[model samples]
Target: FMNYVPDMQKNHFAKEPIMTPPSEVFVTQTIYADANGTFHFSLLKAGQWGFAALGIGEQKTYKGKALSQDAVIWVQATKLP
Candidate 1:
């Protein structure tokens, strides 16, 4: 998990433009998936969370070039009433 930043710098990767701020990350925890390629997180704090699964896709190549597809998601959790 990481904190959200309002301002960010410009950076590019794989023909894609990215903007990320330089700030201290709150947490960097690694979780592994089971044989079915499924994972879960529990007891999470109420806030914004970011999840990324890098290069975990089945397709290893595309158009004769090595390709690694990544997945990312962002979620906002609120406290229970």
Candidate 2:
């Protein structure tokens, strides 16, 4: 187990206790997409869950290549089937 060390920067910006960072902040599993660029995940026992995705890519144009960052998306979990 890792202990949380207080930080002035975070505490000042957040204006909250420089406390527990996050317990469930990391991914427990990774599901890779298939050749169809499609993938999925199972929630096991239905309950509220949260998910976030980040993607980056580069494209070539007539001039040069362009780099970009995809919009961050967060999906709140609901009852699952």
Candidate 3:
């Protein structure tokens, strides 16, 4: 995660970016980059998924037929071992 500065030497915010780990450590780690508005997981389940993110004042969910659909947040569950 990075910040955009109008006339600064580097692209770093005054405050460091906030990083939130997943609730359960055994499963996987969920990192959220607020500055970059992105997220990633340590592990991904290979199958169709229904995602929903709820925050203080935000709530969003998606139910796609397949994980490869053209959507904001869709995961293409590729066969893996």
C-alpha RMSD values across all candidates: 7.4, 8.0, 17.4
Q: Which candidate is the best by lDDT?
A: 1
- Compose the digit string of candidate 3's lDDT tens values, residues 1-81: 112122366654555323433445633334455654566553343443333333523223346322322223435465676
Candidate 1 overall Cα lDDT vs. reference? 0.67
lDDT, candidate 1, 7-64, per-residue tens:
3454422343133434434346687988886889873566667888888878899999
Best by TM-score: 1
The order of the candidates by lDDT, greatest first, is 1, 2, 3
Question: What ranges in model 1 sit over 4 Å off?
Answer: 8-26
TM-score of each: 0.56, 0.33, 0.30
Higher-scoring candidate on TM-score, 2 or 3: 2
Which parts of model 2 are misplaced by more than 4 Å?
A: 1-28, 44-66, 71-73, 79-81
lDDT of candidates 1 onward, in order: 0.67, 0.44, 0.40
Residues 1-81, model 2: lDDT tens digits: 112334676673333433443555533445566666566866543333444333533443335655454443334455645
State the TM-score for model 1: 0.56
